[model samples]
Target: MEKVKESEAIEIDIPLETSLKKKLQQTPRWETFEPFALSRVPYIIRENNKELYEPKVVSIGPYHRGKESLRAMEEHKPRCLIDFLGRNPEIQIEVYVEEVKKLEARARRCYCETINLNTNEFVEMLLLDGCFILDLFFKVRAREPHTLLDVGWGAKTIIADLLLLENQIPFFVVEKLHAIVTHYEGDRDSLLYLLQPSSVSPDLPAKGNIYHLLHLYYQWFVPGRTSKQRSRRYSGILISTEHSRSNPIVSWLNSRSSRSNKKPYKPMRAIPCATELREAGVIFKRKESPSDVFDITFENGVMEIPMLPIDSIRRIIYMNFAAFERSNSAMEHDLMSYVALMDSLINSNRDVIILQQCGIINNMLLNEEELAVFFNQLGDWSTLDSDKHYFAWLFAEVELYCDSRWHKYRAKLMRDYFNNPWSALSVIAAVILLIFAAVQAVYSMYPYVHH
Candidate 1:
């Protein structure tokens, strides 16, 4: 209907390597649990450097969540869009729009508009200023939308797949449940959705089309769609929009599962491999949960894997090409120490390891601060599979190690002060002797003290 003049689209095509393809392959064994891997079967072995274009990659270190989040909002201009949508409620948007408005008004809103998809021209303004939108989808009162379209940079597909499974699609709200599509530009973490109001008749003629959605992805979602080879490519296979205009909306009278026909893809589950990079020894289980780095359990004295060492794998864990080239040894050391500690705990037998400035030797002796640090860093550890749990634990461990080392260093200074009390007495005696000597010298010179 209406287009934001500021937006420009870029297409990216990521060619999957042979190894990456195999890595993405679905092992028929656990297909029921992880289905997205199967649906991605179509593009399993894509070409390398598949052309991709979108907003630049955004970085939010675990330490700087609040400040980075606020900065992202200010840079992304969510407030302007929220205000715009609020005033023009009749403008016809996707379900996501309503969520944004509610959150923008909240003091502590969780959900937010992460990027402005419609406003391409203004995208640069937002990006250059270093702002972002908070994900405010939680405020909306709707069944999470099943289908999702992701148009962001760098491994965003992971987040997108997770969202879809969570039953939350990113869409703007034109009306209470009506989603409108203005213009088609390339996808870049920006999105628009056609809404389906529950109160509306299910038998209505204007439901959305699965094929049209597919075409939209081929057209706008993929980064570099144009460069694909004819025989090797999946371009221009669908009927043109002109052909489908006779009935722009398909009926959802009998709604099907978004993943109805497609099966889930599974990689090998809990395939442990021994890694000996340093004193850091890991029995990494490759195919566990997507979020997990290892897949071993720990209960009582029965650990699924042996504990790893922190000092052993410091080099690889701390080596970030960018940071390394820049010669940030301090940061490198911190990161290395942090990762090592995490690696150790992931394989440890302790069920509740408290990460503190004092390296946790005994899980039984953890204090509140140590527990809080561990829990806070590994926010939902209990819910994770062993792989994720261990990975999180390892990361948290490194941070704790650094803290513990600092604490120990400070403690040593205190211990030294208390250990040698005689040193303080010696200093006092010297001061008293100096005062007496000064008085005697004054008396001898002036003869007032002798009288």
Candidate 2:
């Protein structure tokens, strides 16, 4: 009656392997196909620059495809797809669908987001996006006037949307469609021609390689920037803790070249902008290099910035590139770092003018203040990476030159005595006249001595 004791009952403990087996048997969602290549802009980035991150005109990829605002462009997609298909009257659209079906899994894996689409739906999406992109490149490379080109802002909007990071199909999908449709291996060349059209002939990947459109662009913009993989997919947001915590660009100027880790970083005053540097006798020169556009350098009292062709798409592409870096844990924010460097150089309208006169800034925007604000507001930067010296060294050298009393005095002397071309000529004429007067006075003294 003390009750059939509970101790008499049998205890059944579940085996750990059995639990694991159950978990293993559970249905896997798009997880089995998680891709390391493409991802939407992480919210932290998208939150601050939503306008830039969102597609304004067209959406080529799944990320921004269904937005209400982008609906108008969706109507154009069928037209683009039709034009792309019409180029080869013999090839049915099913041939393109089968090709995309083959790439569907690979393309799906390239996107970090779980594309909740059936194989048929996914393949169709890829084909439509891929054909639209190829059609755009074809129109750009055609060199003949199409009615679309004549349509105001038609060509411009297409070009801009193609550069948006969110608006990209997998490159392999695009390339395969290009080959099947165009009947040649000219996809890469056509894209390079359309994007650069002048100097760049990017050594694009062989068929199966490139990640997406932005990846294609960074390769052209920096030529070898993505030549090597910088981090594993596991690394997560490659920007350093210090960079996010404090503006390292500002920290480096404030820092006193710490030789040891134990030393506390001392913050120095921010370096002067283009105008201030000029007033302190610093020279601004355009660096002509086929290397990275942001390969800024300082030497012999001159700050040489590579000439950046200020174009409409440059801002859009750069914003996407920086966002891509922010989303990936393995990649460094080199694009963001570059923007911070530009921001440091431009503090006001006057600074933009300084760069413009020096041929460093091609102000296609024509509004110096607006351009200055654009650079200033790029990516919510507080400073730059203190440990990294993408431009820290240049800033330090500039700071040293500006701090020199001798440089300041000489700068003042040059400005006061010989600033303009006319001023220099007048000074030379005055010196020659004074020398003649001195000679005449000496001759008069000699004649008096002879008498």
Residue 443, candidate 2: Cα error in Å is: 16
TM-score for candidate 1, residues paired by index: 0.20
Candidate 2 residue-wise lDDT, 76-128, digit = tens: 77888888899999999888887788887778777766678889878878887
* Candidate 1 CA-lDDT value: 0.27
Judge candidate 2 at residue 143 and give its lDDT: 69
Name the 10 consecutive residues with the lowest summed lDDT in model 1.
34-43
**lDDT, candidate 1, 1-451, per-residue tens:** 1233323221123444855777657332332331111021112211221111111222221111234423543443454345334534665434444433442212111122222233432222222221121222211222332222122332233222222211112221112122222233333122333222222232232223221112222222111212222221012223222222222112110122134553332211122211111112222221322211222232221224323222211111112111221222222122222233343344322322322222322233234334334323322111222212112222222222333345455445444543477865776788899999999888788867456
Model 2, residue pairs in steric clash = 236-329, 237-328, 237-329, 247-383, 247-384, 248-384, 248-386, 249-384, 254-267, 254-268
Q: Each model's TM-score, in the order given?
A: 0.20, 0.72
Look at candidate 2 and tell me the lDDT of residue 370. Answer: 73
How close to the true structure is residue 237 of candidate 2, measured as C-alpha lDDT?
Answer: 22
